[model samples]
Target: MHPSFQERIDEVGELLQRTKAARSGFYSRIDRRAPAKPVRYQVVGGSFGMYQIKDLTTGKTRAFRNDYKAAHDLAMQFEAKANRQITVAL
Candidate 1:
């Protein structure tokens, strides 16, 4: 049995709608996994003048004993690397 012209048009329209829905779902999944903001690092002060490198994105901290320069440098390095990753991901 042959499908009438109107039926064929309706089928094509339904297919188009399904394709759009599938594409949106795929992109939504990717967006959910992608970082909402660029990763950042900061040098935070701790007790007794101690310093630490803090990952602002993940809220993780690494301690350094009164070594602000080292902590700052490490934070900068992390931030740079994170920027590179974000650029590559985009």
Candidate 2:
């Protein structure tokens, strides 16, 4: 990884942390009024952890193969993915 790319990734991580911190109750289950519900994926024999990536825009829902990983990578500023199909929202 080039130094410049690494720096960009670090910056993206910082932004994600800040956003998560701003919404502490998000990933937690303490609030019954949580806006989103998690979706599950049963892939043959794979243990797929569930997560969601809301458009926070059109309010449309799509499902991903491996959600959390997809979301994390998408959060990165240096992410090189041009097509969104690799990441489906649920």
Candidate 3:
């Protein structure tokens, strides 16, 4: 698993516990409010393939498309896009 996946797992765990979002939505296993908070992630060209961005700040990571260039571009854009923004293609 990628490092970012671990980070997001931690972050989401905390988020789920705090909000009890896991019990919400059509599927109790899914969090209804999961999409509420803004997360930073990227999908850019990587050494082997596309990569995801691990938020060095929160120690949280998210998996994005496996593309190095795409990941790098989104990482750069996350610096400017609003929190409401989720996906952006570069």
Candidate 4:
């Protein structure tokens, strides 16, 4: 026998709720496998008031700067490079 109008509507609502739950579960699984954000570079003070840009992830020296201006320049250069890569990816 065909379902009444209200019965069909209720069945559809239940199916929609189940589909939404399944989709959310799938998305959560994908999110769990995604890579973490890249660590940022930092400029730290050294002896004699010098500065050095270091990669926070690898603890490697990226550049040495005699003053804040030079340090900022290096930071900007890295930022530009990252931005370019992002644009290219899209």
What are the Cα lDDT values of the candidates?
Answer: 0.76, 0.49, 0.61, 0.76
Query: How big is the positional error of residue 86 in model 1, measured in Å on the Cα after superposition?
Result: 6.9
The number of the candidate with the highest lDDT is 4
User: Which has the higher lDDT value, candidate number 1 or candidate number 4?
Assistant: 4
**What digit string (tens of lDDT, one per residue) describes model 2 on residues 1-90?**
999999999999999999867666664656645444322222221355654443333444333336666654543322223222475789
lDDT of 4 by residue, 15-62 (tens): 999987786787698886332444377788876868988877788888
- Model 1 lDDT, residue 17, Cα: 100
Report the C-alpha displacement of residue 40, candidate 1, in angstroms: 0.6
The segments of candidate 4 whose C-alpha lies over 4 angstroms from its true place after superposition are 1-39, 86-90
Worst 10 residues of 2 by lDDT: 37-46
Clashes of each: 0, 3, 14, 0
The list of candidate 2 runs beyond 4 A from truth reads 25-90
- Ordered from best to worst TM-score, the candidate numbers read 4, 1, 3, 2
- Single out the weakest 10-residue window by summed lDDT for candidate 1: 81-90
Residue 55 alpha-carbon offset, candidate 1, angstroms: 0.7
Q: Which stretches of candidate 1 lie over 4 Å from their true place?
A: 1-39, 63-65, 86-90
Clash pairs detected, candidate 1: none
Tell me the tens digit of each residue's lDDT in model 3 across 4-76: 9999999998987866543444344553445454545544334566476766556665547566666677776
- Across residues 1-90, which tens digit of lDDT does each residue of candidate 1 receive? 456988999999999999877867877988864345544887888876789888777788854647888888887787777767443553
